[model samples]
Target: MIPRLVATDLDGTLLRSDGTVSPRTRDVLTALETRGVPVVFVTGRPMRWVDELHDDVGGHGLAICSNGAIVYEVADRAVRRALPLDRAIVLEVAARLRAALPGTAFALERTHGFAREDSYRSRHVEPVGTPHGTLEEILDDTVVKVLALHDEMDGDAYWRAVDRLVGDLVDVTWSSTWALVEMSAHGVTKASTLALLCAELGITSAEVVAFGDMTNDIAMLQWAGTSYAMADAHPAAQAAATHRAPGHDADGVAVVLTELFDLP
Candidate 1:
């Protein structure tokens, strides 16, 4: 069936391995929008990281960001809505996680940008974020998501461990393969926010087609009526999706869109 809406994750899914969108994918999305089928980018990236992607969705499209803590409008270059973790909950979760996992670094994804603990060293310099500061100083205000970075553990192991500790307390997820964990307020996820948006648009999950390539996209893949897991997708994501597409480097999502919509 032709989907009324198209939802896709960014990293490792719609983007090439180098983290750039291919011209073909961009054009296909723009064409879909022209045809009255809205394309939504659902990702774990924060608002700061998404500012440059305004032209990706024909310069004006909605994005579900920060694993569902934010809804950004590309053209307007504004956050239409922000769902931040309660400061009290953030404090409680941080304390419990620190005690459970020694040497873990903490960071906050604020509404405007990012901040982190002084000792925290990200795998790469974040495109946008303040220099390191004390955890308390970084989190002085409410934040959309909390980051838990570990030095010695692998991504899968550390995430599972965090799940064992605070899975019930907050929404835990990760998009990249690095030893990083992201937490949101409980019950928040790409799927939840997308569902709300779909409701507002008078669309149903069955009329939506979603795509992703990581563990963070599992809930969304399962929520859509038809889901595409990129070829290099995490095992859980592949298991959750209704179908599989080529790797992002191969323009897997574009291949599927072409088939589904008869795009050139």
Candidate 2:
């Protein structure tokens, strides 16, 4: 059955590991749009990253950004809506996390730009001297995600430690293996955002298809009517999804799309 909507993750799902979108994948997505099937990019990525990429994949639509904390209009780079973690919640979580996990550094992903503690080394290229201060000092009117990383923890240990500290307080998940934990409003996730958007569009979960790879993408993978986990997807994602596609580098999404829609 043809879906009314299709959703996909970016970093390690839709885009190759090197962050390139294959031409075949691009064309297949275009074909879906032409057939009146709306495709949504549901990712943990910030709106800023959408501002940078997504143009290559017909980004003139709405995107679920910041792990459902933000709805962004790709065309104008405007925020349609934002479900933010309350400032109080942000502060409280940061405090608890800091005390429980020594050497845990912090950063903020605002609706507009980025902010981080002086101790938090940035992994993304941001404008010079991006706001630097305590998490309390750097906070703005709207904070979509609170990014936390440990100086030592990198993979599973990092995930386990952070998850233990605040998993009960807010929604916590990770897209990368950098000991980074992305926290949003409690219970907010890609699935939450997708469901909200589908409601607005008058579509049903049974009418949607989704694709993802990481833990951050798991909720979305489960929520969609038909979902695919990438060949290299985490074990949890594989369990959540209905099927598996080839890895992103192989244009796995494109291959599945081609067979689904029979696009030339």
Candidate 3:
């Protein structure tokens, strides 16, 4: 069946290796929009980051940011809903991580922005082109996610330590080299957030198709009607998907969408 909605992950799923959408992929997505099929970007990125692509990809539909912690409607430029982090839990987890991995860089993601300690500026090198902000100002608002960024640190080891220490209090996952760890409230995830959006759009889980490529995307990949893992996906992500596409650099999403919808 042709899905009524196509929900996709951004960084390593839909976006190419260069972090840009290919012309062919963009054309296909635009065609999907023309057909009135909602294309929702379900990503670990913050709402402000989503704005960077609003004029391009988001012109077609809403976005699910912070891995489902918040949903934003592009047309109205308003937050449709939000699942904020528990303030106490966030503080507790942050304290524990600081003690366990002293000198490790960390950031907090709020419904509208992201926060980082002043020390993070000099010690950590962000991914090329990604933005940064101050933690003090950001924490004054409702937080939706927390991230740990460190180089030369064993990501799996850190994740294990975090799980052992605060796993019961938050949801933890990673999208890239263990250099980063993303945390959300105990029950908030991309899957749950997408389900809510499906209801709002009067669609059903059976009519949704999703694509992803990392541990953070597992839940949503498994929840879709037809889930696809990128060819270069992590083992956990591949195992959770119903099928596999080529790879992000290969425009895998567009390849799968065209075949699934039988589009020319």
lDDT per model vs. reference:
0.88, 0.86, 0.82
lDDT of 2 by residue, 1-264 (tens): 878888999888989988887888878877887788888888888887877785685453578999999988887777888987788888888888888888888899887688999899877787676899888899876888999988677667777777788888889988887788899989899999889999999999999889999999989988999999999998999999999999999999889888887777
Worst 10 residues of 1 by lDDT: 51-60
Q: Each candidate's TM vs. the true structure? A: 0.96, 0.96, 0.89
> Which of candidates 1 and 2 reaches a greater lDDT?
1
> lDDT score, residue 236, model 2?
90
Alpha-carbon runs more than 4 Å astray in model 2: 58-60
lDDT of 3 by residue, 21-133 (tens): 88889988988988999999999877777776766686778888888888988766789888888777877887887788776676777664555765564333444544455
Model 2 Cα shift for residue 181 (angstroms): 0.6
Cα lDDT tens digits for candidate 1, 1-264: 799999999989988978888989888887787788888899998876777666666363788999999988877878888888887788888888889898899988888677889888877677553757777777755599999999988989999999889988899997767789999999999999999999999999999999999999999999999999999899999999999999999999999999999987
Q: What residue runs in model 3 are displaced by over 4 Å at the alpha carbon?
A: 121-138
The CA lDDT at 241 in model 3 is 95
Candidate 3 lDDT: 0.82
Give the C-alpha miss distance for residue 118 in model 3, angstroms.
2.4
